[model samples]
Target chain A: EAGVAQSPRYKIIEKRQSVAFWCNPISGHATLYWYQQILGQGPKLLIQFQNNGVVDDSQLPKDRFSAERLKGVDSTLKIQPAKLEDSAVYLCASSLASSGRGLMSEQFFGPGTRLTVL
Target chain B: AQSVTQPDIHITVSEGASLELRCNYSYGATPYLFWYVQSPGQGLQLLLKYFSGDTLVQGIKGFEAEFKRSQSSFNLRKPSVHWSDAAEYFCAISSASKIIFGSGTRLSIRP
Candidate 1:
């Protein structure tokens, strides 16, 4: 089976401009996630979705960031009026649903989109 | 609040030397722990995870980690380092339905 897929492996935009990233999760996967990874730092979870509904998005910047998953398969993350601090890699991941850690469903990650804001 | 900590920012080891990277976590209940590796400009790859039972767990690429509940630590280790093992490693913890990640540690291989 194919891994999680993402579009536009790299992107560059000026401050105040807008940018968007897309993700296609693995088939039959029920959970999808978006994360931001700054240079020299671990990836930070931005939002998580389970079957087209949001499970968590506490870390998302409400004013500048927005995300959506339709049909429970594909997702898109957007940044409006972007700032220089938004320069980071946008990673997408997916995992199968399981009852507990005993089954332990690990997440599969995409190559990620590297965004640079000037 | 749950959190993960990785004190080492960078580490260098000879290709044939042993390697260890430290990780600590703070959570109320037992947490699901994980280690992931990322190559330059690439996405993260799961090395291993620990949920319950067995303090020591083996992962892909000959990597292993020991989970110590008493010390609230999970450390990744490799018997012998390889040049291809050079990458950024991250430790993460999941508790109360929330996942927290450490800052990460960069590993460099010496010829």
Candidate 2:
């Protein structure tokens, strides 16, 4: 099976600019997630989607960041007026949907797009 | 919020030597545990995971981990190391819905 796919691979923009990243999860996977990985740190969850419906997005920066998964398939994460701190690797991941810890499953990640804001 | 800790920020080992990376999690209940590895310019790859039963769990690439409930620890180990093993290692903790991850451990191999 093909793995999750992400685009651009890398990006560079100035502060206050805008950028967007895309992701396509593995076939048959119903859960999708967006995570930010800062240098020397673990990946932090930004949002999660279960069949186009948001399951968790408490960590997302609503003021500048927005994400959507239309038709429960592909997803896009957009950041407008990006800040210096926004320079990080944006990762997209997917998992099989179940329920609870016992029901949920492991996450498969994409290659990720490295974004640098000057 | 629950958290994960990896005390060693960086570790260096000789090529062909044995390797071990420590991970400790803090949670009120028994949470899911996982270890992931990331190479330069690449995304994370799942190394292994421990949900329940049998404290000792094995992972890919000749890696294995021991889950100690008494110690709240899940450490990854390898009998022998290789130059290709150099990468950033991460330990993550997950509940039914939410998850948390440790900062990470940088493994360096000396040839």
Residue lDDT tens for model 1, B44-70? 999999988999999999999999999
lDDT of 2 by residue, B1-111 (tens): 689999999999999999999999898987789999999988889998888898899999999999998999999999999999999999999855756779999999999
Against the reference, the lDDT scores of all candidates come to 0.90, 0.92
Candidate 2 TM-score versus the reference: 0.97
The C-alpha stretches of model 2 lying farther than 4 A from their native spots are none
Per residue, candidate 1 scores C-alpha lDDT tens digits across A4-105 of 999999999999999999999999999888999988778888998888998888999989999999899999999999999999999999888633432267
- Residue-wise lDDT of candidate 2 within A6-89, one digit each (tens)? 998999999999999999999999999899999989999999899999988999999999999998999999999999999999
Best by lDDT: 2
By summed lDDT, which 10 consecutive residues of candidate 2 chain B come out lowest? B92-101
